[model samples]
Target: MKVLVTGAAGFIGFYVSKVLLEKGHEVVGLDNVNDYYTADLKYDRLNELGISKKEAEIFKRKSVSSKYSSFAFIRMDLEDRTHLPSLFENESFDAVCNLAAQAGVRYSLENPEAYVDSNMVGFLNILECCRNHKIKHLVYASSSSVYGLNEKIPFSAEDNVDHPISLYAATKKSNELMAHTYSHLFQLPTTGLRFFTVYGPWGRPDMAMFLFTDAIVNNRPIKVFNYGNMERDFTYIDDITEGVVRVIEKPINDRLNEKEYYKLYNIGNNNSVKLSDFINEIENNLEKKAEKQMLPIQPGDVERTWADVNGLIRDYGYSPDTPIKEGVKNFIDWYRSYYKI
Candidate 1:
């Protein structure tokens, strides 16, 4: 199958692209390569997939990976009205995994426009292109943050997600709504995966695992938000990639109602580990104690997030099982090797 994976330079997108290539699928990856965190890290991820820094710097040009002939990349934004449609007309992708978006809950508070452009306008472009190109499946990245202010212990796909605490979450929720609209009106098979606290090697610098590991290794203080009272279902990258691959292979069909072609699932670990316990795993792996600075939860921050992935397991025959200790150890090892610490 020929697949188009947006945000291929991103953490999850990189892993997804690598796995797809390994399965002998031809993959065309697209990413804007914005400097929301660090462009060097994004480029490094591309390098791992055989896209050179020189090739990745040029926008809108397709560059094939030297390591995997089936994998190629293009540097472009999702919101580009002209080039996106042109690419769709040219490629005629069999399936599209749309993982590209401006992703930081707290950062959205400072830069609301960025969220609107990438997550809102950018997603619309993806839908339009998929609609026009007759793409078979459109699997997109949503967030557990969409279940904001809900007192539910384990967040389920069936539960109400009408209240999103952050602009990032709002945009993600909006993507789900937009996907349903296209799926209903145009008979597109769309699936939205509400990811939990995703973390592993090649992870984003802004994420908690990366931040805590970096601070601990450097002998700096690690900020404990919510005064050390928080929990998250930190899903591993490998598990996420595997689940996404399965979903891509199995697009929604006419076995259900015509309007029910749209589906949403919580792709998460299903085990919410406490914040202090998660920190302990990192400290244990690094053989160092963190200088902890307890802080109040910032605005747009949720107290806790736990995903109920039974629906995913039932549908996809898979569930995330990586333990927090193992995941943190893998991250710490990668961090030390990457930073020469």
Candidate 2:
């Protein structure tokens, strides 16, 4: 199958593209390569996928990966409706994994319009493209943050996610709603994966794991949010890639009803780890104790997040089993190697 992976420069998307290429699928990677965090890291991710920083720097031009002949990449944004449709028509993608978006919950508080443009309008373009071109499957990334203020221990797809604490979560929830509409109206097979706190090697720098590790390595104080009372279902990157690939392979193909065409699953470790325990594991890996700055929870932040991944387990016959200790060690090894710390 030929797959178009949006946000191919992203952490999850890069891993997913690598796996897909290894499985003998043709891949066309796409990303705007925005400096939301840093374009350098994004380019480095692309570099790992065999896309040269030089090739990826040229906007809207397709570059074939030297490392993997089956892989190709184009630097572009999702909301570029004119060019996006052209790419869809030209590539004739078998499936699309939409990981591209204005990520970071806290950043949304600062720039809410970015979320609306990328998550909402950009997603609409994807839905339209899939519906118009008759794509087989669409597996898009959702988030555990959508369960904001729900008080639900293990966030389930069946539970209500109407109250998203951050604009980022709201956009993700809105994507699910838009997907449902597309599936209902056009019978487009769409699968939404509500990802838990995804952290592993080559992870996002803005996330807790990276921030804490960076701070500790630099001998700076790490902020212990909510006074060390937070918990997260930190799913490793490889596990997430596995689940996403399975969903991509087995899209909601049955045409029983509109609901049948649209599916949602929580891809997570299914085990919540306390914030302090997580920090301790990182400290263990780095062999350095972090200076802690105790602070209250920031706005647009949840106290805890636990994903109920029974649906993922039942359908995909897989679960995220990587222990926190193992995941942290792997990340630290990669972090130290990448940064030469």
Candidate 3:
């Protein structure tokens, strides 16, 4: 299978591409290499995949590694509406995993336009390209934040997600709606995965796990939002990559006689962990006490997030097996090795 993976330089994208290559699938990686957090980290991820910075900067196609001859990388952005169309027309991708978007919920509050451009407009472009190119399947990254303030214990794909608290969540919800439209109108098979608090090694720097780990290792104070009352279904990256591969392997097929081919699922750890407990695990792994600064929750921040992955398990056998302690230990190990902490 020839797979087009957007945001290939990102944490999840890098992991996903690596797994796909391991499965002997041809993967074409696309990313703008934006400096949202740190482009160096992005490049380092690409470097792990055997793409050099010099070659990546030259705007020419590059191979993944010496062994993975089927893998390639391209320097492209989703917002490049003109060139993006050409890419699909040329590559004729068998399927697309759309993970490129303005990621941070808090960052959305600061830069609303970025969200509009990447999450909304850019996603629209992907839908258009998928529809026009007649791609077999399209799997996109949605968010658990879409279930804003729903008071639901474990968020389900069937839950009402119309009322989103943050602009980022609203955009993710809007993406589901747009995807349904394309699926209904053009018979495009689409699946949206509403990811929970995804955390692990090579994770985003803006996320809590990375931030807290950096702060603790550097003796900086870690801010406990919502007075440490928050709870999250912190998911490991390996589990997420597994779920994604399963979905990619089994494309939804509701077109023959069914009314709709669009579907959504929550990809997350079924168990929710308290914020303080997560911090404790990190502290325990690092063998360092964290200097805590309790503060009110910032805007666009949710009090809690949990995922009901029953549907995922039933459909794709997606079960998160990594415990929080083990996940934290892996992340701490990576942090220590990456930063020599």
Candidate 4:
């Protein structure tokens, strides 16, 4: 199968692209390579997939990597509807996994426009392309943040997600609604995966795992948000990749009895870990006690998050079993190696 994976330079997207290439599938990766984090880190992720910094810098449409014969990359943004359509028309992608978006929930509070442009306008372009190109299925990245103040311990896709706490969460929830519209109007098959606390090697710098690891290794103070009362389903990257691959292979199809080919699933570890416990794993793995600065939870931050992935397990045999200790160890090892720490 020929697959188009947006956010190819991103953490999850890069891993997913590599796996797909290894499986002998043709993959065309697209990413804007924005500086939400360091562009160097994004470039390094591309480098792992055999894309050169020189090639990435020039906004190349198609760069064939030396390592993966089945892999190609395009430096493009989802908001650029003109180029997006042209690419879709030219490549004729079989399936698309949309992971490109302005991601940070906290950052969204500061820069709301970025979220609107990337998450809202950007997603519409994807839907339009999928609809026009007759793509078989479109799998997109939603967020557990969409469950926002629901007071539900384990969030389900069936639950109403109308009260998103941040602009980021609002946009994520909006994506689900837009996907359903496309699925209904054009009979396009779409699936949205609400990811929860995804972390591992090559993880985003803004996330807690990366932040805490960096601070601990550098002998800097790590900010303990919500006074260390926070809880999260710190899902491992491998588990997320597996769930994504499974969903991609099995495209949702609207039956005579069903309304449309639209579905959503929570891709996360069911086990929730307290903030202190998580930090303990990181500290133990790094052999360094982190200097902690207790802080009140920032706005747009949720007290806790847990995912209900039973639907995923039943439908596609999805199971996330990576322990935090193991995941943190892998991350710490990668961090040390990557930074020469």
Candidate 5:
């Protein structure tokens, strides 16, 4: 199958693109490569997929991978309706994994417009392109953050996500809504995978795991939000890619008849681990104690997030079960090797 993976340079998207290529699928990658964190890390991820940094830095110029004949990448934003339409017409992608978005939750408080442009406007363009191009499947990333302040134990797709605490969560919920509109009216097969706290090797620098490890290694104090009372269903990168692939390949769920082809599932570890325990794992792997600075939870932050992944397991015959210890060790090893620490 031919697949177009948006946000191909991102942590999760990078792994997903590689796995698709390994499975003998033709892949076209796309990302604006904005410096939300740092464009250097984004380029490095592309480098791993056999695309040169020189080749990917240029905007709108599609470059075929130096290593993988089945893979190619383009530096472009999703909100570019003019070019996005043409790209869809030219590629005629069989499926699209729309992982591109403005990303950070707390950052949304700083720049709410970024979330609207990338998550809302950009997503609308994806729907229009998929609808016009008649793409078979549109598998996109959603977030567990949509659950917001709900007291729900294991966040389920069926749970009400109408009240989001942050702009980022609101945008993700809006994506699911927008996808549902397309799926219902156009019969497009759309699936929204609400990802939990995904962490592993090649992870994003802005994410908690990376921040904690980096601060610990540098002997800087690590912030313990909610005073270390938080919990997260931290999933590994490989598990996320596997689940994404399954959703991209599998047929529409039973909920979809001729009426609506929309599906939503929580992609998570199905188990929550306390923040203190997670930090402890990092400390164990690095063999260095962290100078913890306990602080109140920041705004737009939830104390805990646990995804109810029964729907995913029932539909995909898969579950994310990588032990926290193993995942942390893999990440620590990569961090050390990548940084020469």
Candidate 6:
């Protein structure tokens, strides 16, 4: 199968591309390589996939991977109206895994326009291209944050996500709605996976795990939001990628006769770990105590997030189960080597 994976330079995207290549699928990875956090980290991830920083700089130029012949990459944005359609027409991809989006929830508060451009306008381009090209399957990244302000203990796919606390969550929820429109009208098989607190090696620098680890290593005080009363269903990157691959390969075929081929699932570790416990795992891995600074929860932040992944398990026959301790150890080892700290 030929697959087009958007945001292939990102943490989860890079891992997913690797898995798809291992499965002998010809993959064309795409990314704009924006500097929302660190462009160097994004380039380094591309380097791991055998795409040189030099080749990645050229816009829309497909760079074949030095290691994997089946894997290639293109530096481009999802919102490119002209180029995106051309690429779809040329490549005629069998499936598309749209993981590209402006990610941080808090960052959306500062730069809401970024979210509108990438998550909203950009996603519309993807849907248009997929619909025009008649792509078989379209699997996209959603977020657990969409279940904002809901008092539900375990967030489920069926739960009402109409009220989102953050702009980022609202955009993600909109993506689901937009995808459903295409799925129903054009018979496109679309699946949205609402990811939980995803963390592991090659993780984003803005995330809690990376921030806390970096601050702890440098002897800086780490902020404990919500005064250390937060819990998250932190899912590992490998597990997330595996579930994505499964969904991409197996599209929604149950409702082929009815043209109701849209679905959503929560991809996360079913167990929710307390914030203090998660910090303890990081401290254990780094062998350094963190100077904690308890603070009130920032705006656009949720008190806790717990994913009910039964829908994913029932449909894909897979669930994220990486223990927090093991995931933290892997991340710390990678961080030390990457930073030489």
Write candidate 5's Cα lDDT for 61-84 as tens digits: 899998899999999999998899
Quote model 1's TM-score.
0.98
CA lDDT of 16 in candidate 6?
A: 94
Clash count list over all predictions = 0, 0, 0, 0, 0, 0
Off by over 4 Å in 1: 254-259
Backbone clashes in model 2, listed as residue pairs: none
Compared with the true structure, model 3 gives a TM-score of: 0.97
Tens-digit lDDT string for candidate 3 (1-341): 89999999999999999999999888999888888898888988888888888756655354555546887888876888888999898898999999998898898888999999999999999999999999999999999999998987888889988789999999999999999999999999999999999999999999999999999988999999999999999999999999998898785763224656888999999988999999999999988899999999999888988899988888876688789999999999998888876
Per-model TM against the reference: 0.98, 0.98, 0.97, 0.98, 0.98, 0.98
Clashing pairs in 1: none
Better of 2 and 5 by lDDT: 5
- Put down candidate 1 lDDT per residue, 218-315, tens digits, no spaces: 88999999999999889999989998998987857733465577999999999889999999999999999999999999898888889999898887
Clashing residue pairs found in predicted model 5 = none
lDDT per residue, candidate 6, 64-110, as tens digits? 99989998999999989999999999998999999999999999999
Each prediction's whole-model lDDT (CA): 0.92, 0.92, 0.89, 0.91, 0.92, 0.93
After superposing candidate 6 on the true structure, give the runs of residues whose Cα lies further than 4 Å from its correct spot. 254-258
Question: Cα lDDT for residue 213, model 6?
Answer: 95
Error of 3 at 270 (Å): 0.5
- lDDT of model 4 at residue 142? 97
Q: What C-alpha lDDT does candidate 1 achieve relative to the native structure? A: 0.92
